[model samples]
Target: MAHVTFKENRITLIGNEVKTGNKAPDFTLLANDLSEVTLADTTGKVRIISVVPSIDTGVCDAQTRRFNEEAAKLENVDVLTVSADLPFAQSRWCAAAGLENIKTLSDHRDFSFAQNYGVGIEELRLLARSVFVLDSKDNVTYVEYVSEATNHPNYDAAIEAAKAAN
Candidate 1:
């Protein structure tokens, strides 16, 4: 279990902690393109799983754009922005932002992805803001569950970790 604070109140997450060097949990999520994408689909590529509470927020939007720009320069690396938003909404945001490199995925259909990755916000109908980096073989290289849900993640460190893993 992990404790996360949102709006100055601490909330406990009732799930397992995914640590570095551990095999990443596999999940099926709906891509903005309306296609099913799984962890297996990203095999042989370094992955950045960007879990956000909602893409409507400023922090989440900024993070997605940042990753999209960074992804353009990286080879064999995929940046996946995951949220509970619907596929249509995610597609609309990416389209408006002109985001082509970063893939936006939705977990609205079910909480399988969030639950398996231990990122679900138990009290709220959203996923806890977090980031996870995985190697080509699906080994977790770095994982960060932002203690403060409203704050943006350490993108520099997460990007550096992903590059190092590659």
Candidate 2:
């Protein structure tokens, strides 16, 4: 498991840590509309999976918005923001932010995506901040597990990996 801290306090992560070169795990997350979305649903495109604790929070909001803006210029890339926020809240945030290019999915249903991707924070019941980039074939090309939950990830590195993935 990756070392994680929430607000400078150590926390426990409750799943397997993902590493580059490994096949990205498939997960079932709830879309803003309540429909189920899986990794298989987006197969042939470079995927930028942005994991956040909550979309309504400061850091998470900025992270998602940054990806939403970046998504506009990336061709053949799908940017999905995964959070434990309820689908209703996710929809509200996206709409209010005018985030059209990125899709915000909710993992509040089961934390399936969180557990599978090793971002689940057992103590807080929220996902640890992280970013993952996967190729069209579902192979992970970049993985960032932010050391502090409140900090932003290495956006440039993740974006560059997505751009380079075929």
- lDDT per residue for candidate 2 within 2-33, as digits (tens), equals 89899999999987899999999989999988
Clashing residue pairs in candidate 2 (N, C-alpha, C atoms within 3 angstroms): none
**TM-score quality measure for candidate 2:** 0.98
lDDT, residue 22, candidate 2: 99
C-alpha RMSD of candidate 2 = 0.7
Clashes of each: 0, 0
Worst 10 residues of 2 by lDDT: 106-115
Candidate 2: regions farther than 4 A off: none
- Cα lDDT computed for each candidate against the true fold: 0.88, 0.93
Q: What are the root-mean-square deviations of the candidates from the true structure over C-alphas?
A: 1.2, 0.7
Q: What is the lDDT of candidate 1?
A: 0.88
Residue-level lDDT of model 1, residues 43-106, one tens digit each, is 8999999998899889899888888899998887899999989999999988888889988999
TM-scores for candidates 1 onward, in order = 0.95, 0.98
Off by over 4 Å in 1: none
